[model samples]
Target: MRLTVLGCAGSFPGPEAACSAYLIEADGFRLLVDFGSGSLSALQRYAGLHAVDAILLTHLHCDHMLDACTYVVVRRYAPDGPYPPLPVYAPAGAPDRIATAYNISGESVDDVYTFYGLQPGSFPIGPLQVTVDRVNHPVETYGVRVEHGDRVLTYSSDTAPCEALLRLAQDAHVFLCEASYLDGVDNPPDLHLTGREAGEAATKAGVGRLLLTHLVTAWGSEASTFEAAASSFDGPVEIVRAGARYEV
Candidate 1:
């Protein structure tokens, strides 16, 4: 399995990166996790506009899903004519929320996307087996674990420290986690995880490697975030870089 970092900036796009988005490919199947703001353009760097086979959204936040609105336009009016409705798995009320965000009337959004409400369970998407668990976030968020053959990758979409996240990350070959807060600063509860927290979670889960992501540039330096994570986790830890690819 191959994992590509499409974007890693938190909350909003930074000067060098977009918001959260990742591309996972295995056995000729392409799956996209999170289509955040500015990600559609970045995605074109690595894949054709229509190459994505399926999408999984962790939550409905603008930084995580807003680009999906623009994607509808691309799919609906492409020169080849409208493509088949793409499968999108997201939290409940996602269709209505996306319709509202896109400001489209009637079933226009539905014409481009076939929405499926995500639940806490395991399901198969092409060659990958995915397990979803509810994480600690204000909204209905899910952390996903993807397994293909002997390889496993876990993504902590956006969450505070929680048991569900640890369980989902257990024994994962790569733990892609969000580190949105400064190490020693105070942050709102049930919102995001600090680099230390993310590292600790990875340690507790006994993951093989930890890749820190979702760094809010305004909060502090990215290097400091890496330091904070390394302080807690004894295994390999690195910050995610956009356009970088990892084999799992």
Candidate 2:
């Protein structure tokens, strides 16, 4: 599996990065993990607008899903005409929420996207095996574990410390985790994880590599986040950068 970090900024777009988005490709199929704010423009640098086969949304937060509305416009009124409706897997009420965000009729958004409600279970997307689990978050959020052949890649969409995340990341080749809070700081409960907590989870899960993402630039420097995560995790740890690609 090939993983590409289209954007990695947390909560909002920073000067140097966008919000949360990733592209995964394997066996000639392309799957997008999230379509966050300013991600569409960045995605164009890697793949065409119509190249994506499917999209999986972790949750309906604006930072993670707002660009999906812009994508609807791109697909609906392209030069050639409307493309086939793309399949989108997301939480319940995603279609309605996106429609409201787009400020258009539901049919308009539905015409461009065929929405599938996500549940806590395993499913197949093309050649990839996907497992979904509920995580610790204020909203109905999910973390995804994807497997292709013998390689496993787990994405912790956005979550605080949770058993479900640890289980999903078990023996993963790559753990794409969110480190939204700094070490030794007070953060709200059930919202986000500190870098140290992320490292602890990576260590406990025995993942091959840990890629820290969803960092808010306002909180601290990327180097500090990497240092905090590396302090706990014994294995390889790095911060995610937009436009960077990794093969697993």
Candidate 3:
């Protein structure tokens, strides 16, 4: 399995990074998690806009889902000719909201991408296995555990520290978590996790690697935050950067 960080900023985008987007590939298929700003372009650079096999959305926040609307249009009406509909697995009610947010006719967009609503549990998508767990966020959100063969990767998308997330990521080879706030930078209740909080979750989950993402750019250097998170776990800890790829 291969895990790639497409975008990893929080609240909003950084000067060099986009918002939340991840590319996980296993068994020769690609799955996209969260299509934030510049993600479509990033995917294009990596493997063309049409190379994606499916999309799994965790929430409907602008930075997490907005680019999906744009992607639908491009795939549906691009001058290069239309591509076949890609299956999209997302939280309940996501399709309707995406259609409305982009001012797109449901039929027009629906013809280009088949949308599937996911609940908090396991589901299958072709050669991969997926498990969704509810997470703590302002809106309904999910953390996903994906497995293919002997490899597994879990992602906590914009969530606070929660038992559900810990259980979902248990024993994962890679745990991609969001640390949206610094310990003392105007903490937001029920919406985000601090760097240390993410570390604790990873340690409790017994993951092999802890990859910290969704950083708020205003926090300046994340060196201190990464160091703090590292204190909790003996595994590899990485502060995600765009264009970096990890093979597991």
Candidate 4:
């Protein structure tokens, strides 16, 4: 399977940056992990607007999901006649929640997207098998594990260090984790992981690689975050770059 980082900015986007989106492709199927603020534009750099086959939203936070509003418009007004509703797997009430974010009613957005409630379980999206587990976050977030044949890729959408994340990331070829806080800072609990915590999780999970995302540059230097993770994990680790690609 191949993974692409369309965007990785955290909280809010800086100039020319976008927040929290990923593209996972295998067997010609494109499964979008999240479509956050400013991601729609970035997505076009990798694939066509209509190329996405399905979507999986980890949580309802705007920084992680709001650009789905723009996605609705893209499919709803495709030069071709309105296309079939795209499948979207998300938390309960996502239809109403995203519609509200877009200032429209759920019924209107429903025209372009079909909603499926995300629960803790395993399911299939095209050729990929996905397992989701609740993670440590303010909202109802889920960390995901995707399998294509024997390859595995895990994503820690937005979370603090937690057992569920460790289990989901267990033995994954690539652990795409979030490090929103620096190592030596006063950070709130149950919101985000520091680079050290992320690396610790990777070490415990025995993942092949640790790729840190969701970094808010205002908090500290990216190099410092890299140092923090490398201090804990004795494996390939790096601060993920937007538009970077990975094979898992």
Candidate 5:
């Protein structure tokens, strides 16, 4: 499996990076995780948007799902004409909410792309097997563990350190977790994780690699933050900077 970091900034677009978005490709299938603000441009530059097969949204936050609605329009009205239906996976209640937000009719959704709302559990999606788990967040959110053949990739989405996250990512080849705050930043009771917490989770879960994302724009150099986080884990720990790629 190949992992591409289309965007990695937190909250909103930064000078160097966009928001949260990732492209994972394996076995001729491409899956996108979170299409945040300005992600389409980065995706087009990195992983061709036309090559996308499916999109997995972690939540409805503006930095995660905002671009999804616009992307549908772009694909449908492309000069080359509309392509086959693309599969979009999301947490429960996403279809109705997003459809209303996008002003799309259900009848018009005939295959060119369809939304599949997932409950909290394991399920199959195309050639990729997925395990979804609820996470500690203000809104209804889920983290996904995607498996293709013998390779496994787990994404924590946007969540505080939670047991479900550890369970979903345990022993995975790659753990794409969110570190939305710096060490000293005082986060609210149930919001996001700090860099150290992310590292601790990856170490406890026995993840092969810890790839940190969703970093606050004020977090300074990603390399420095990741180095600090790595102090907690013996395994490989690195920040997912914009335009970075990893072969997982």
Candidate 6:
């Protein structure tokens, strides 16, 4: 499996990064993990606007899902002609949230993408084995675990430290985790993870690599974030860039 970071900035977009999005590909199938604010523009850099085969939204938070509304416009009005509806796996009420963001009714957008409600379990998407579990977050967020053959890729959508996340990411090749708070900050509980917390989880899960993301400089320190993760986890660690790609 191949992983591409379309956007990784957290809460809001950075000057050079979008909010939160990732592209996972294997067997010629492209699965989008999240379509956050400003990510659609970044996505066009790595693949065609119409090239995405399916979408998996972690939650309805604007930073993680707002651009899906923009995607409806792209697919609905593309000059090449409207393509077949894409499969969209997302949290319950996703269609309504997306439609409301688009300023249209849910039924109107339903024709553009087939929506599947996400739950805690495993399923198949194309050639990949996919699993999702509820995470500790304000909204109904989900962290995804994708496996193909012997390789495993897990993404922590947006969450505080939780056992379900660590269990889901066990032995993963890559753990794409969110670290929105700094090492020494007194962050609130059940909202986000500090960089140190993310690294500790990766260590406990025995992941091959830890790619920390979801940074908002306005609220957290970026340089210190990486430092904190590195101090806790003994593995390859990086604060993912907007277009960084990795093989799993």
What's the TM-score of every candidate structure?
0.98, 0.97, 0.94, 0.97, 0.91, 0.97
Looking at model 5, residue 30 earns an lDDT score of: 87
lDDT of 2: 0.92
Candidate 2 regions exceeding 4 Å error are 104-107
> Residues 1-248, candidate 2, lDDT per residue (tens digit)?
99999889999998878899999999999999999999998899877777699999999998899999889889899999789899999999899988888875555587889999999999998899999999999899999999999999999999999999999999999999999988776788999988999999999999999999999988667777789899999999989889999998
Candidate 1 stretches with Cα past 4 Å from truth are: 104-107
Clashing pairs in 5: 85-111, 85-112, 85-113, 86-112, 86-113
Q: Taking the candidates one at a time, how many backbone clashes does each contain?
A: 0, 0, 0, 0, 5, 0
Model 1: residue 230 alpha-carbon error in angstroms: 0.3
lDDT of 5 by residue, 1-248 (tens): 88899998888988889898898888888889888988989988997868688888988888887777667777777889787778888767666655565675543443356778867988776688989988999988899999988888999998998899999999999999988777765668678888788989998999999988888767455665676679887898877788898888
Over 1-248, each residue of candidate 4 has an lDDT whose tens digit, in order, gives 99999889999986657998999999999999999999998899877677699999999999989999878778877788588999999999898887887775445588878999999999999999999999999889999999999999999999998999999999999999999899887898889999899999999999999999999997677898999999999999988877899988
What's every prediction's RMSD, in angstroms? Answer: 1.0, 1.0, 1.6, 1.1, 2.3, 1.0
Q: In model 5, where do residues sit more than 4 Å from their true spots? A: 100-112, 219-224
Candidate 5 structure, TM-score to reference: 0.91
lDDT of 3 by residue, 1-248 (tens): 78888888886778878888888888778889899876777777766777688999999988898889888778878898688888999888887888887785554477777989878889887678999988999888999999988888999998888889999989999999887777757786889888789899998999999999998878645987797789878899999898899986
How do the residues 180-208 of candidate 1 rate in per-residue lDDT, one tens digit apiece?
A: 99977768899999989999999999999
Residue pair clashes in candidate 4: none
lDDT, candidates in the order shown = 0.92, 0.92, 0.85, 0.91, 0.83, 0.92
Q: How accurate is candidate 6 locally (lDDT)?
A: 0.92
Give candidate 4 regions above 4 Å deviation.
104-107
Span of 10 residues, lowest total lDDT, candidate 3: 104-113
